[model samples]
Target: MIWQPLLLSLKLGVIVTAVMLVITLPLAALFTRVRRRWLALVESFATLPMVLPPTVVGFYLLIAFAPTSPWGAWLERTIGLRLAFSFPGIVLASCIASLPFMLQSLKSGMQGLDSRLWEASYSLGKGRVETLLRVILPNMRPALFSGMILTFAHTLGEFGVVLMVGGSIPGQTKTISVALFERVEALDFAVAHRYALVMVVISYTAVLALNLLQRVQLERRS
Candidate 1:
């Protein structure tokens, strides 16, 4: 029972981190190049997840996934996919809740990049995509790792949004955090302690590794 929820949380974290990397990379690069006015709006929108309460985001997502809504109706009619109280729904909610962490990290990395490197890549006849791949990405390894770690960690501990969007369906939407809550509600203190300890250790280790990596990266650069 404990292993099931732990595995589910791990799976969700991996999927969410992978998806976030794909979506945030190019978006962060775009933000780095855009003018200040547009960049401000984009940053605000991207960072809204961090600013807004998780329940608020979950509430709007619930509305969007309600059967009466156009999106929900269309999804059900066309693909037979339901977002409310589903595994995929929780994944989507986790992605949104954790978006700002990945985006902000990558964006900060991009912004901190030396402009001369971009100029040099262009002068060497590399196109934008080529330069981004060969020059920018290689230099942003620290940020990439940091973003992935934070996103994965955040998703693993997600509770409010997951509860609102996925409920506590065992083996489907019941991740470790949900399981922990359930265990506590059932007054299973021993099991809840185990789950909480595991989460705390995992989260702490990931952050510690990220910090050490960043320090090494800085030392290498200097």
Candidate 2:
């Protein structure tokens, strides 16, 4: 029983972390390429979901996903997908909640890059997109890997947003954190203990493994 939400959380975490990496890479690329003046605004927007209370983002997303709005209506009409109280909805929530981890990691990595490297790439006839994929991402691998682990762990603990939008739909959106909360509220410490311990071990081991990998990468590069 406890394993159900635990596994679901893992699945959601993997999906969200993967999507966040894909989305943040080019979005971070835009920040590096575009006007410096717009960087702060872009970053603020990207990280907004991090600072805002989860319920606020959830509330707004809820509104946006409602039947009336064009964006929500189009999503439903075009894809036959509904964003409320679904696994997909939880994934989107995880994406939003974890956005800052991805952006910040990518941004910090970008800042460390030598300007001359990009110039050299252009001089060597590499295009922008090609350079990004081949050169930039290679350099950013360590940061990107670390960011993904952080985002996955953070998404596992997500509650308020999941609560507001996902509504504890078992086998669909009831993540381990939500399940833990349910057990705790019901004074079922025995069950909650099992869930919490699993999460603790998973989070600790996953992060430890990533950090070790990062250290190894840095050592090899050095």
Candidate 3:
């Protein structure tokens, strides 16, 4: 059906965004607090995915997830989960590809916080966890929103990495971008136009909302 790939893309985006949020939030918080040289290296590594070619990341991931590799072998033998060309596999790939978008946005947000807020919370006998939940996170709403939107948008448009890792398994790994590519190759211009138009609208709306959010945050700060 025409809606299958679009729906699958939405599903992939949501899952990838949720996973990145869980994985990147703590990392971003920690990065904002740390200043060691080694931490800089770690941060650089975390952002490398954004700079690397998608196919390069996909190639390495493909090898790592191959059944002959130790990690893949152990995963299969222990839990009977095979990642290569599978839904979970593409999920992991999308997570990696989208990590920097979420991480950088959140880290910037965390860094933009005034030091006095958390210090004030500490002086008031609030613990780190309490301050993070009540004070820190509440202040970073713009960053959170921006990160989620960016991650979801990026995942929806993922093609090279998704194709290299998951291939074109319909109803499983065939996302909107992948489906669009297939349509074009098959010369199905009408269907391809539909997919392209949807992506454009979604991407523009997300960016516009992010811009408005930033403007509002700036206005409130001033």
Candidate 4:
């Protein structure tokens, strides 16, 4: 059985989760601090992906990455990197598709932080970055783990967005989900079953870990 697709999926999930954590941590913190009337609009924009169809997101990403589009053209001309139909393209698409999972989880954690803790840190002359790293992050361990796991698992199982952006380039963009679809299309049910079973196990493991983590968190709180 071909293993490249599964490996690619794992690589994509790790990269996506790492990047998402870096980007989402600051964004979630910012979201929790904003008190303006337009905060709802900003939040809705961030959470839009959770409800939007994966195909719809993929369609827009495809257009944005097309060689003729200005963004795509600039990247190609400046960096000599074309995102469309490439591994990077799949990563970008998965990032967008799985963003809300991380954002919401992190945001909820950030919001739960006591305002007095921020005040105390500031009183001690700690910078926002220092406070976030030293205090906020330690307290946010559960949420961080949840977000990372969810993003990783979600990206691993992504079908529509990855397919639309990356196509089925072997050892490049053919992730496990896309590979499974191709196998089924080629009437290779036996191989498809193997892929499906693997995915099932992955999904079950993620769910079990999340539940255990939640139980631990609840016990600590109580």
Candidate 5:
């Protein structure tokens, strides 16, 4: 029983993290490079989820992804997909909720590097895309690694958005966090505790490992 939820959470986190990295890559690059007036607005939008309660975002997702809204209708029409009370809904919710961590990490990583490196690369004949792929991305390994682990852990613990958008469809959308709550609600405290303990240990171990890796990488760089 716990295995189902545990595996579901791992699946969700991995898929969400992959999509987030790809989708947010260009946005993060543009964000870190641009000298635009709207940078603050975009930054604020990404950071809003971090500050707001997950329930607040979930409530809006319910509305925004519901058939009543044109945006949702258009999405459904285009992709032949429904968003409400579905696994896709949970994925969408988690993606939105976890975006800031990835974006901030990537942005900070890009910004922290010496700008002259980009300039030098560009001057030497590397195109923007090439330089980004070969240089910027390599340099951002630490942030990218940390951000991925953080997002995975956060998604594993996500509750409110999953509850709001994804009904606990036992084999489909029942992530560990949601499953744990259901167990508690049914007064199955023992099982819930076990699930919780596993999650805590996994998360702690991942962060500790990532920190040590970051330290080693930093030392090598210095």
Candidate 6:
């Protein structure tokens, strides 16, 4: 029983983390290279989820994902897929909600790299893509790990956006957070405790690992 939601949360985390990585890599790289007023506006929009209330974000996402909405309707009609109250819906929601954490980490990593490295790569006749894959990414292991783990951790605890979009469907969208809420609502403190404890342990471990990684990076730099 408890294992179900736990496993679901893990699945959700993995999928969302993977998807976010694919989505953010180029965006982060772009943000790292570009300097313009419009880019700041785009960055702000990307980072908005961190500041906005979860419910507020969820509410708007819900509207957008609703079948009645043009975006949702076109998706369903064209792709034969539905977003509202579905696993894919929550995945989308989680990706949007966790975008900034991964993007900022990778962007910071890119920005921190020696600009001379890029110049050297260009002098060596390497394209931007080759440089990113070979030179930039290899040097940013800490940031890569931080982005992946933080995004995974954040997805595990996601409730409002996921709940609003995916609802509490068992064996599908019913993540540990949603399970915890249900257990509490049912006056089942024991099960709720288990769920909550699992989340705390996982989230704390992720954060601790990130801190330790940063410390190690600092030590190596010093």
lDDT of 4 by residue, 12-62 (tens): 999999999999998898888878778889788878878998999899999
Off by over 4 Å in 6: none
The residue-by-residue lDDT of candidate 5 on 40-93, one tens digit each, is 898899889998999999999989988778988998899988888788889999
Candidate 4 local accuracy as lDDT?
0.92
lDDT of each: 0.92, 0.86, 0.92, 0.92, 0.88, 0.93
Better of 5 and 6 by lDDT: 6
- Model 1: lDDT to the true structure: 0.92
- Estimate the TM-score for candidate 1: 0.96
Task: List, residue by residue over 67-159, the lDDT tens digit for candidate 2.
Answer: 677887899899998888889888997798889988888877887788777888999999998998998889877777878878888888888
- Which model, 2 or 6, shows the larger TM-score? 6
Compared with the true structure, the alpha-carbon lDDT of candidate 2 equals 0.86
Question: Which regions in candidate 2 have their CA more than 4 angstroms from the true location?
Answer: 68-70, 213-222
* Regions of candidate 4 where Cα sits further than 4 Å from its true position: none
Global Cα RMSD, each model: 1.2, 1.9, 1.2, 1.0, 1.5, 1.0
lDDT of 4 at 55: 90
Worst 10 residues of 4 by lDDT: 34-43
Clashing pairs in 6: none
Tens-digit lDDT track for model 6 on 121-216?
999999998998899899989999999999999999989998999999998889999999999999999999999999999989998999999999
lDDT (10s digit) by residue, model 3, range 1-222? 778988988999999999999899889978888677789898999999999999999999999988899999999999999889999999999999999999999999989989899789999999987888799988899999999999999999999889998999999999899999999999999999999999999999999999999899889979
| Higher-TM-score candidate of 5 and 6 | 6
lDDT of 3: 0.92
